[model samples]
Target: MKFLQWITLTCTVLIVSCTSLFCNMAYVTNEGSNTISVINTATNTVAATIIVGATPIIVAITPDGKTAYVANGGSNTVSVINTATNTVTATIGVGSNPTILAITPDGKTAYVINRNDNSVSAINLATNTVTATIGVGVSPFFLTITPDGKTAYVTNEDSNTVSVINIATNTIITTLAVGTLPRFIAITPNGTTAYVTNENSNTVSVINTATNLVTASIGVGIKPFDIAITPDGKTAYVTNLDSDTVSAINTATNSVSVTIGVSGSRPKLLEITPDGKTVYLAYEDISFVTAINTATNLVTDTIEVGPAPAVLAITPDSKTVYVPNSDNNTVSVIDTATNRVVATIGVGSQPLAITITSNPQPPHSLAGKKKKDIFATQTDRINVITWSAPSEGISPVRYKIYRDAALTNLAGMVSASNALKFEDHNRKNHTVYSYYIVSEDLNGGLSTAASISIS
Candidate 1:
């Protein structure tokens, strides 16, 4: 059996939000200021700002969540941010105009897309240096690693192709011709297929990973540029920029199943919560972000944000989402439950990308395997939490829970209780509350922390 290489939580302190657990340190790249804003999600504000290269466009977190690599388009370098200190510890030169980055699952390397040179730079994470530069097609923008970390697929915008790279050898094994102006790419959870969004063609090319071939091209709305796939890999969501809409593609058939309109023009980026319950998209023209319910495929809430909200990234616990406003020089924090702007943080000028990276749990441990289905409902003055039990290891002896980011006080001290649910009395309707759950085994072993936010 393959064992997980668990790293000491000392590498970096970037916030990683997902189903893995919880992280408070997330990083945002500011295009205008040439720096990265370190966001403390617990406070929904910018905690620190670290200077990097010029026009840093994309950031990638190592799988271990200890370090973040920022691609500087103007400086032709990559800045390594150590999460622990929120500082730029190292700078490695790469090809000119690096736009995107993808780290392998093992957290050992990062693949950077250099648009000007039409190549991908493989950086050694431990050494903080570039190991190899593999040539791809024209203007490569985005890349995604497979679940197994064996292969990487990069989207080339100008050549309209997807280059498949063998991670072991750091070489381009093959390139599959895709749609016009392919910009964003996503691989399914099962690692069977990859979906590339074509902006000019307004279509998404579904590629069979085994054969490295484009198996299907599904028509979306006008100018489909970005995409987000569900955790189960059952569906793919594409943001149609020109149409001001989002196309929901059913991955089973590779067809457009639903089209949800945005609040304003230029629906640039979209992301699904870790639970796969809601989809959030940023509207550049209207200065707003819209939240859509996956069940009914209807707009649930519309939040006013800074100018040109370009990217959406959610925390691991599905509690908070950060949207970088390109023109306003700010980042908007959205409370997932309330679907409102809880905080407006002044980042560097023209922040374009937001990335959350955290120290993840072991692959199959009680904490890693205990990804829970957390649900919250607010009725009048009370907020109730309901969740399925942890699936791995022994049943928890009792569930201990806390409210807010800081474990200030016990919500209700019901020790050794078997109740799978709890109700927080007297919670305001619009007040966002963060909860952390600890599952203690019979031998007094406290499992990894599971968290959620209720409003």
Candidate 2:
């Protein structure tokens, strides 16, 4: 009998551990209700409704996935929620009418754009207090932080400009003129480029991060309001408010690649799935979340949500979507796999924007991972190569050497901790060979090909 009881206890613990590991959750900000709705991904159900500040317009989650900061437009404050408990722990006062918010990559600070005050308020996440207020243009609407978390690009609606703020100093560094009534801003994953949607001009401005200048302006559709880029950073989707269409842009050429029509009227917010396979858009009047097939750039299905859907967010696993309905003071949860509305969660008044905190932890590489510079010199009968470790924080794993597209185990397994300098002694005179390195993480995740060639 005791053995049976021990066996049962072991099984119960295993079940609980597996459930916790697989159950990802989606979060939505209810602007009208001043609350946030948390939906369980596994069951497509409401896990919790978190009360926040008055009129929460946007919510940003910290990088570590521990806290969520909500911008309350009506209350002129930001609500900090503890993700573990699904409760508001603190409220930081900011400028008036905070419409949107973004957290730095380091998770140390958050930038809130005050639409009425025409300024950006910087909040210290540790203390939950507004530390700096920087003047921006008229009606600052949306803001995006660079991938490196060093700079913030904010769209000023009435001013038709983007205010660039240096995160280190908490000050406005420069303002680049974009288009009329710029409403949204999106930064590339590489932190090298930025895109801004001009609602009045129906165009998207491409800004070069290095120069802080508008490099190109691509005509999109009627009244583009929200923009998002794919995970690969190859394509961008802009929602056309008036035309009920989504404009897809090719990042390489900075041109409109295609235009996808959304059956619902007034598509307001757009979000891409983690795998970059699907896009979820919220339509206000139609009260639905439309799912688009990214491959063909066409609407595949529409999941009926709450009344007057304001914003939407996708879970990190790409299995669930959360939509906030302004009119109903509720949030609708959608199952991505089945393309259906699974649950409706009640929250505080008017939710404007939602962001998720589930950034996947990259795989760790094996030891002795070798790396070589793309540009290396070779002497007579000798090839000299210099290499460095891959980007930090990445997994430290093993390396596989390749020559002329063929795998060569000559270097053996090398540690990723040290930079390697190798000389090819077996090279034939006047022969040309291409060398490459492959890193394998503990989880078997492989690095992209990094290659060098020598003659």
Candidate 3:
């Protein structure tokens, strides 16, 4: 009888300097000041601020976390920031008023939504230049790219429609009429379904990405402005602007699971932690943020931030959160463990949105099994392991394979290649052995693991 054991260890680390004072950074777009604030998360202070175009509203970071793209609504251009230098490296003219931005999964292209012109600009990341211009519904306010890097969905606020674009051709493949005014969109982790929040219609439109059709229209709180789905893709939380409540919907049944009321404050935007344990809400009319426990669907912590917090983002470690206070031009840093404001860093005038670069994530669908070494003539035994590249975030530079479950026993390492596989040669028969696999990015940040055992 033979026994073989396998274990996958996901080493997810923040891609930043451990030796230097600065580790992770948060980029905030200042609309009133027309600049970007770079906040160092380690010290909880502002590292630098770079000037950009007029009225920057949104920011998107590439998968590698080396570059940032800012949408300047007033100047109708996109400014590219080199993260290493913290400077404006390039500025590409987009459209009349670019309000939203999204980067593809491959990190090669960026799509900018110009609300006034009703068009989208595809910018090539390599050259930092506009490569294509695609038209969509009127007054497109938000955009999201699928996990496969093949399609993009845009919500047109004025036209009450969603424009589906093919990334390869840079053209609108279809336009589906949705609720009265679709303001924001969120895609599930698997990229199988997209949920669109219609502001005027007060309904959530669920779309099937495969057929590009509306699967269900879920009634929710009044004037739903923003939506975010859990990492597991099981539940979605929608913030109702006017009703001062958040509607949690079960993705499986497309039904409202619970409606948590924020009686005094109006919830403007929200995000769920990567671990899917807590849901944070930022209010436009108030100065505090509400943290809800995902398991119990109840309010766990109410943290006081700056005046009129506009938007917020959580770090990959799920230990810290950064919220841009639009009224005060400052960012409130909250510690996840205590749910208190640890520091407040002054940014620019009217900080609207924030985005942080992510650490490399573990490869998907990792599996391994014992097999015969066909190329060898000595009747040797081997273990062949295979996986798909990470769905998003920083790409790995190499994969390390360990012989022991504790990951202290070094076996071998493989470079990131198209093969997406590793092999352990000359394995002993009828003996139990364990293998551990992890991904390492260029900056030496390790990924979190997914386990797969071989018999």
By TM-score, the best candidate is 3
Q: Estimated TM-score per prediction?
A: 0.77, 0.73, 0.79
Better of 2 and 3 by TM-score: 3
Each model's backbone clash number: 14, 28, 9
How many Å off is the CA of 68 in candidate 2?
1.7
- Best to worst by lDDT, what's the order? 3, 1, 2
Instruction: Point to the candidate with the largest lDDT.
Output: 3
lDDT value, candidate 1, whole model: 0.77
RMSD of each: 12.4, 13.5, 7.1
Off by over 4 Å in 2: 1-21, 348-352, 359-455
lDDT of 1 at 307: 82
RMSD of 3: 7.1
Go through the candidates in order and give each one's C-alpha lDDT. 0.77, 0.74, 0.84
- Candidate 3's residue-wise lDDT over 170-198, tens digit each? 98889999999898899999999999999
